[model samples]
Target: GQQVMQIPQYQHVQEGEDFTTYCNSSTTLSNIQWYKQRPGGHPVFLIQLVKSGEVKKQKRLTFQFGEAKKNSSLHITATQTTDVGTYFCAGPPDSGYSTLTFGKGTMLLVSP
Candidate 1:
């Protein structure tokens, strides 16, 4: 079975600071997806990476995939109170159905 894991389970930052989270997979991934869940809200898809050493950015956020395709990272600049949420990374395993396995998630809290 394939597994996705995230580091720094929790983070607290002052408003206008920065934040980051890392994700790793137990097995090679065909693709990886990122999501953000607001406080008490459902997970919202952010982006997906398929190629090795790929990088993508959305406004103040940046995402990267390792050249080995076994790890990934998300970085946020100038964090704001609106950025408080849990970030997750998910990917399909090498076996069986197409269901995705999600990482434990990194929780971010921004204080004004």
Candidate 2:
């Protein structure tokens, strides 16, 4: 069995500050998924990274996959109240599967 390790467990940033969260897995992955869960809301799909060194961005948020496909990261620029939530990075626990094993999410707290 493999596990995904997410760092920090929690992050607090002031408005307009930057924040980053890292994810590492015990095994290589074919793809990874990012999700954002706002307070009192369910997780919402953000994006999927598949390439060895993939990078994607949505507005002020940037996502990256390590060249080895065993790690990933999410960076948010200029945090805001709208960005307050828990961000999760997940990957398939093994090959030939679509079900994902999620990290223990990095909770983001933005103070205005």
Candidate 3:
């Protein structure tokens, strides 16, 4: 069985501040995905990484995958009220199945 864990279950920041979250897997992953869920909304896929040491960015958000493919990170720059939400990292284990295991998620709160 594979397990994904995220740190700092919650984060609070004032407008214009930055935030970051980390994820670790119990087993190596073939690929990893990131998602965001706004208040009362379903999770929305943000990005996916398949290669080792991959990095991607969307506007003020940045994502990174470890070279070992067992860890990941997400960073947001200049937080805004609109950015409040929960971020989740998921991935499939070395197993051959397509099912993915998701981390607990990091909840972000932004204040003006």
Candidate 4:
């Protein structure tokens, strides 16, 4: 069976600090995708990395893919209230098809 793991079911940060969360899996994956859901909102695709050791960033947020493609991490620099959301890391099963196994996610809360 395939499984994905995410830590820190919740996170709290001030208006201007850094935050990070990690994800790992028991088996190798062809690719990994990230999604973010704002409070009372649906998950929206943020990014996808398919190559081993790939790294990508958007503004203050950075994403990394492990060499084995069995793990990944997301780092956010200079947090803002607008960044508040649940970050989900997901990967497809061996059978594939765009169907994803999602981690429970790390919920971020920011105080003004």
Candidates' C-alpha lDDT: 0.93, 0.93, 0.95, 0.92
**lDDT by residue for model 4 over 1-112, one digit each (tens)?**
7899998899999989899999998888889999999999999999999999999999999999999899999999999999999999999854566678899999999888
State the lDDT of candidate 2 residue by residue for 1-112, as single tens digits.
8799999899888999999999999988889999999889999999999998999999999999999999999999998899999999999854778778899999999999
Candidate 1 local Cα displacement, residue 53, angstroms: 0.3
Kindly give the stretch of ten consecutive residues in candidate 3 with the minimal lDDT sum: 92-101
Root-mean-square deviation of Cα positions for candidate 2 versus the true structure, in angstroms: 1.0
Model 3: CA > 4 A from native: none
Write model 3 residue lDDT over 1-112, tens digit each, in one string. 6889999899999999999999999999989999999999999999999999999999999999999999999999999999999999999986777899999999999999
Q: What is the lDDT for 100 in model 4?
A: 88
64 Cα displacement, candidate 1 (Å): 0.2
lDDT of 1 at 25: 98
Error of 3 at 72 (Å): 0.2
* True-vs-predicted CA distance for residue 13, candidate 1, Å: 0.4
Candidate 1 residue lDDT tens string, 68-112 = 889999999999898999999998864545789999999999999
lDDT of 3: 0.95
Off by over 4 Å in 2: none
Q: Which one is best on lDDT? A: 3
Residue pairs with colliding backbones in model 2 are none
State in Å the error of residue 85, model 4: 0.8
